[model samples]
Target: MSQQTTETTPARLPAAARRGGGPPWMGAGMPAEKSMNFLPSAKRLMGRLRPHRLQLIGVITLVVASVSLSVIGPKILGHATDIIFSGVIGKQLPPGTTTEQAVEGARAAGNDSFADIIAKANVLPGVGIDFDRLGRVLLLVMLLFAGASLLSWLAGYILNGVVQRTVRQLRSDVEDKLNRLPLPYFDKQPRGELLSRVTNDIDNISTSLQQTLSQLLTSLLTVVGVVVMMFVISPLLALVALVAVPLSVWVTKQIAKRSQKQFVAQWKHTGALNGQIEEAFTGHELVKVFGRQREIEASFAAKNDELFKASFGAQFVSGIIMPSMMFIGNLSYVAIAVIGGLRVASGAMSLGDVQAFIQYSRQFTQPLTQVASMANLLQSGVASAERVFDLLDAEEQSPDPVKPAPLTDRHGRVEFERVSFRYEHDKPLIEDLSLVAEPGHTVAIVGPTGAGKTTLVNLVMRFYELDSGRITLDGVDLTELRRDTLRSEIGMVLQDTWLFGGTIRENIAYGNPEASEEQILAAAKATFVDRFVRSLPDGYDTVIDEEGSNVSAGERQLITIARAFLSNPSLLILDEATSSVDTRTEVLLQRAMAALRSDRTSFVIAHRLSTIRDAHLILVMESGRIVEQGTHAELLAAEGAYHRLYHAQFSQPAIDVDEATPPPAVPGAPLLRQR
Candidate 1:
């Protein structure tokens, strides 16, 4: 299928693309076919084979053998029919021959002409042909057919079951890979497309297994098997039979080329539509608040129109192949019939041969058209595979070269040495910066907007690499630690709390799956989650909706905080929002934070300077650089950026940030330290 170049919203393009999007064809020459290789997905799929290989092997073997039996049975029947019809069973004699004469001749008791006697001896009587043996032959054929059919059904059931389990296995694998994927892969693709690979593509492949799928390999094998048999019957007739093969192939190729493109368009549009719906539904609250029902509907309608066009084009093209093939098949059948009949009359061939040829022709056409549609599946699978592989291909943070030095005591000494970094090198987010926090001390990062407060903590947590500097936790470089181990070593509380759909206990246990029940209870109590848990009808077992959509924001935050506390990491970073909870809940949360942060290396990114006034160090950052570093007492004495920021926030009842209050972006705030 020819691809139509889509013009993205200019605003949405990355800076590099925004400069020109591309020469003429944007993202062209890029593999329109998904991935270049299937090795990775194959390897991943094969890994699951260890557990299911034996079952799969059994199913595959049965399917192949059973399908072959089925196919062979029909050809055998057609051949047998030809044999029966072409004078193999001469029960009745030629005209004018009497049955009594034949019996008497056989007994040598009748006086007749030599020719008459010969006819009588050679055939059964003219009118009274026996039907008994024919019935038995038919019964035998039926028995063979029934057995083959039963085996085919059993094979189908087994293969179908195996395919279903395999799909499940694939889904789990993709999901696990998603968790491990580097963030860049997600940045380059859409979520709906990824969702399609995990859900839609696997389903498509599984559905094909319901019957003998029209996969190219199976269809080719079946066709080849039938063709070889046809040749065995009559080489000349087989050559004649192949006259229409090329024509059928050409027709299929045309249809397939057109259909493949349409199929791709159909899927792409479906993903776009799905993305729109997902976005709208996920942000339903924002939509309601803005009262933009019509706006959302218009956006949905636009995507729907595109989807309809793609669907109509795809289905219409796909729908044409069968009828077109059938038409050709009919023509081929008529040609074979006319030619075979003349040849038979001329003593060039037997009637049985013509009958079998007809069966062979039908087999070829059905699978040819069926095989044509299989390309559609293959293309779709490749598209889905490409998306999945893109994720698997993303660059991960480099593993540490040296084993991280394990520290016994939690000495919260944090230091940044000439740290400098940027998400994009051309646009520096955090320029040269440095700071230190003594053990047993708290560090506060304060910035106006894009000042890099969060970036500071991000660096502290080793979420990103330092461009030309090193960040050390107790004198150990952050990069010299296992990612999972490092992450587990630090606890975090963020402004946006995430919760999965599950019972309260499950969500809490997500942080520490191995935690004891008593430990969970203790953590819940510390974070003021006990009250909400007790209030639920089912207490801790009360289930939440996806993303904890069923619960209040405050409660969700508390649950997340409880999880962090339960972790009990040696180091903690809290990007606390200025937003407040209920007075009672606030008091409980403050007490919880104090307890959680006590004696641990703590970094707090906060706008409420009052909250972090007790920290041992207060570093104020601006324009990707640290402007001041000191205690509240020392900073208040310095009368610099920290003093102005603290006073500016409290000076007026309503003070607006000039040129927009720059909040941190992801890896937010340039940070107080370059590292």
Candidate 2:
């Protein structure tokens, strides 16, 4: 018997692309930066941390204690400076001179300002530097600063755990969401784009939080603590330092607003570029065969350039915040210095107080600078958060019933009642289709490409919900049964075989994990897999590579068939299951399927007319309708659609073969040679 080749129709644009609202990169012009919802997205992102509130509270307490200790050190150091100054002024005085006499002497010299300062200093007339007193103050200052450092480090350690745990939960949610999404959703999305969201975007959120969360908390607390200390020492200078606060805030806000959009664009393009690269590499062999390497390279270059522009824009815009804030801080620092100096000279404030106030002024501005710099990281993280949230918010498949209808007595019968479905609203693919497969019967579906062959089986598998009708198994509506329960009773083998990177035994056991070693070996032998496995060095223990490139196409198909056999499902579906196998292996596979299909309902989709000769019922479909339905011989006698298809397969001339002479038959040779 000659084999017939089946060709699939070209893929159409995704539903989203067919409409005008596809991904940003798919549009003709340069991709536009999407406007960011910074506040709402940020709030939602922070909500992910709610479960770790107790740890956050502890972190805040530690930060406060640390900042308070750091703020007090400058004031104590100022006191040491006052002690040395008093000693120096008193040593210059005559022995036995009182504090009053020193003030009177400065007045007599026409330096009344110095006289007032000396009076307030309370310096002893003949005392030199007091090394003992200075030592105590210095030691206390060192201890305060050291304690502050320790507490800050401990706070950061705790916060790191909190951030990591929160991000881990977020990643879990994304993974769960992907599983719940419908098959059509995946069809519309690019594989690499979805991967970027799961891996890269989630990782970016983790890094941003780790780098900024603890530091931002500490900086804000430092700002509050320094302000309070500054007021205690000198209210006048504290007011001068605060004049820069509003200006710094305004600069950071304006710059962050612009950079937020760019950050969003940056990550979006990153996903698009990843999608392009994944497609190119996956089909690289086909690309080389068609000599399209230059075209592929050019496409990659364009996407890479778009990513570059977005990254540069995001970094450059956010980069302006820190420098602009520093400029404002410098202006305030100069003003406070001049005013504090005058206050000390006039004796309105002590010299030590002025020194401490200057230090506090710098502390205040430094925190503000650190915060401005962190804005960049925060914006990038929030952008990724928005992308993740979008996925979580997508429409999910309908939920299963709380109390699902059970299938206690196993009888393999399936019925479709006026079924209708369409990928797009305006274009219908299957409409009002009805069919019935009786218990323990083989129903074979044969059709041209895009004739709704796969769609019909997909409906039975509940991969998609019907538009206007219902499908049932054993008199129970599919919707009434849980998806897991329904799928558990069925086994499927597809034309495209999938094998994970694991031992051949592991791959076969994936179909039924609880199957015994004996059962696995039996199934393999039945499917002609044991013949090939025994030839390999490791036999059944041979490890398949990630791409499964180590196995021949015929071997891979046999393994998949063996997997289906191990399942031993009540209903079986084989879609072009033997297309990849050679003539000898295919014959063995058919015998295996025949045994497996005994006393079970089976749906076989095939293009080769010879394979379905024994099927109890044959359905010829065209343009989503069943044009003819009967036994293979009955349809052939009618000389209708099925007859024409069968004749076309056999009548087609062999490529490069003599017209009068038939091609020589060889064992294990392809029945239909390719042109």
Top model number, TM-score: 2
Encode model 1's per-residue lDDT on 1-675: one tens digit a residue.
000112232332344433222221122222233444434544554464467667667755655665566456555565455435423324444547565555456457533343243342234444343345546656666776677567656755665666678667767767877766644345445555467666776675455443334244356656776678778766776777677689878887787667666666666666666656665676677778878777778777877887799778877886777787778878877877787777655546555556767777777666776776555555455445545555556676565567566755557677888999776667786777777877667788888866677667767766557888888777777777666666777778777666777899888877788899999999999888898889888999999988677788888888888888888887877777324356567666776788787888788888877788788888888867888888899998888887778777788656555657665566754656547
Q: What ranges in model 1 sit over 4 Å off?
A: 1-130, 187-190, 208-218, 400-409, 577-580, 656-675
**Model 1 residue 401 CA deviation in Å:** 5.1
Residue 530, model 2, lDDT = 95
Off by over 4 Å in 2: 1-36, 654-675
| Residue lDDT tens for model 2, 335-393 | 98899888878888877888888888889999999999999999999999888888898
